[model samples]
Target: MASTSSYSSSPCAACKFLRRKCMPDCIFAPYFPPEEPQKFANVHKIFGASNVSKLLNEVPPHQREDAVNSLAYEAEARIKDPVYGCVGAISVLQRQVMRLQKELDATNADLFRYTCNEMPTTQPAGAGIRRINEAAAGASSYPQSSVYYYNPSPWNNDLCGDGYQRGGDNNM
Candidate 1:
C-alpha cells in the first residue's frame, strides 16, 4: 500500500524557526551572542569591517568624539532640550525610581517585620533586623516622590504633608 502522507518530522524549533543550529544556550538565552564569532554568526548577518567603519564615519564628528572621549556631554545636554526632549531619560528615571521604590518597600517590610510587632533583640536569628532597620530609617529621611498639582495636595488639605503647610492652612 502506497501511503501518500506528508506528515514527516521537521527540524527542531531552534533550527527551523530561529534558523540557527540548535544549541543549549541558544535555546535558553538566544539573545546572548555566541562566544566565538563563527558559532554566533551562523544564524545572523555578518557585517564586514569596512561596513562598520563606514557607519562609524557616518556619525557626526561631535558624536564620534563624544563616544571616544567616554564623556557624552553634548548628548546629556541634548536630553534637556525641548526639541530633543527627555522622554527616554524620563522613562529611564521612572524605571530607576520604581526599582528604588521596590527596594525601599522591601527594606521597610523587613524593618517592620523585625521591629513593629516583635521586640528588637528577640527577633529570629539571622533576621538582619539592625541592618534592615537602618536602611529603612535612611530611606525615610529622603523625600523622593514627585507630585505635580497646580492647586494643592490631592489628599486631605488639613494635614501637613510634604509640600503642604500645617493645620490645613494653604497660606502657611
Candidate 2:
C-alpha cells in the first residue's frame, strides 16, 4: 500500500460533486470543505451549482462567506418547511416577541399600581382628587393622551380594593 503522506488531499465538496479537480484558487474550496458534503448538497439542491458558482464569481471574496451561509440557511429551512419556510419561522418569532412585550408591559403596570398604593397619602384626599383631575385635563389636551395618561384608580379587583371612594361614586 502507498504511504499516507503520498496520497493527495481530497477535493472540496463542490469540486467532488462536479467531478473536477479542486484548484487552489477555487471559490468553493474554503466554504465547501471536503469534510461537509451536506453543505454543498443543500446549496446545490436549492440554487443550482452553476448559479452558485456564478454568484460567487460576481461578488467580492469577503462577502461570499455570508452569502453562502444565508443560502444554506434558506435551503435547509425550505427543505424542512416547504410551505412557508423561513418566512413562517420569522413570523412566529415576531409574534413571540410581541407577546413577551405585552406581558412585560402588564407586569410593569402592576408594579406601578402596587408602588402607588403603598405610598402614603401625604396630602388631603381632596387634594389628591384635584391632582388626578388636573392630570386628566392635561393629558386630554394632548392628541396622544394614551401614552401620558394612566388611570391609577384601579378598575379591576385584582390590583386594588374598592376602599377609596371616588367623588361619592363607589362603582370603581
Candidate 3:
C-alpha cells in the first residue's frame, strides 16, 4: 500500500504530468512516484495515459512494478532511436557479447598453446613484469625485441604479440 505521505506531498508522476488530483486510490501512484516525472512522461508519451492505466490494472498487483519498469525502459529506448529502438540496442549488445566471446576464445587458445609448449615465450625472467611497469609508468611503445610486453590494462595493450589488442578496433 502507498503511504499517505506520498499522497499528501506533490502528486504522483502520472497525475502531475496529467494535471489532475492524485487521490489515495490512484492507479499510478505506487509505481510512478512523484520524484521520477520523466519515467511517467516517457511512458505516457509512448503508451498514452489510458492505455498505461489499463495495462497496470490488467497486470497482477505483484507484477505491476516490473511491468511499469519495462514500459519505461522501452519508452526511453524508443525515444532515443525511433526506427530500431530496443532492437538496435539489443543488436549492439549482442555484437559486443560475440566479440568478447571471440576474444575469450583467442585467449584460451593462447593459453592452451603456452601450456602445450608450442610457442617460444622465452623471455628473461621478470621481463614481462618490468615491461608492464614501464608501460604503467607512461611508455607508449616499447622497443622492438623478442621480449613480449604484457600490459595489465586490456584496452591500452599496444604490445607486439598474439594479444587480442593488436589490430582490431571497436566502438566500445
Candidate 4:
C-alpha cells in the first residue's frame, strides 16, 4: 500500500493518468502512488477506472490491498498471455512438479536397492534367513541377483561352492 502523505503534493498514478485532480480522499491514491505509473496504466487498461473504483469501494478496507495487488498481477499476466494468462503459468508449474515427483520416486527406488545390497547377509535366529520372493522382488526395480533360493538349514550342505543355494524351487 502506498502512503497517502507521500502522494499529497503530486497526483497518484491513477489521477495522473486520468488527468484529474487527486483529492486527499482519493481511493486509488493509497494503492497507486506517483512513482509507479505503469502499474495503474495496465490495471486501468484491463479493468476500467470506474469498475475499479466501484470494486474497491465495495470490498472491505482490510482486503482492498490484496484485491488491488491481485488485479495488477492479473492485468500484467493478461498482457503477457491473453489466452491463458496466470493459468498458463500455473499449468507449467504443475507439470514441472509432476515430472520432479516421478524423478524423485525413481531415485528413491535406486537408493533402496543400493541400501539392500550393502546390508549384512547374516541374520539372528528368530529373524530367519532373508529370501527374495519371486512375485515381490522380481520387479525391474530389484535386480535378478536379489532373488534368493537358499535353504538355511545347518545339516543341509546342498549350497554351491560360491555359497549360493540352488536345485529345488526354480521360477524362471
Report the lDDT tens digits of candidate 2 across residue range 1-172: 1011211377888888888987777778878877778988988988899999999899897798888888889988888888887998999999998887656556645654654554356744433222222233324232333332333334332333334333333465
* Error in Å for residue 2 of model 1: 89
TM-score of 2: 0.62
What local lDDT does model 4 show for residue 157?
A: 28
Model 3 residue runs over 4 Å out of place are: 1-5, 118-172
TM-score of 3: 0.62
Candidate 1 achieves a global lDDT of 0.37
Clashes of each: 1, 0, 0, 0
The predicted structure with the larger TM-score, 1 or 4, is 4
Residue-wise C-alpha lDDT for candidate 4, range 1-172, written one tens digit per residue: 5565555579999999999999988999999988889999999989989999999999999899999999999999989988898899899999998887656555544443444464445633323333343454334443466555333333322333344545444432
Instruction: Give the lowest summed-lDDT range of ten residues in model 1.
Output: 1-10
Tens digits of per-residue lDDT for model 1 on 23-130?
442221222232323322322223332343354467664454333222123233343553443556677889998887656555544444444433345555542223
RMSD of 2: 13.0
Q: Which pairs clash inside model 4?
A: none
What TM-score do all the candidates reach, one by one? 0.23, 0.62, 0.62, 0.67
Candidate 4 segments exceeding 4 Å error: 6-8, 123-172
The superposed Cα distance between candidate 1 and the true structure at residue 114, in angstroms, equals 0.7
**Which is the better candidate, 2 or 4, if ranked by lDDT?**
4
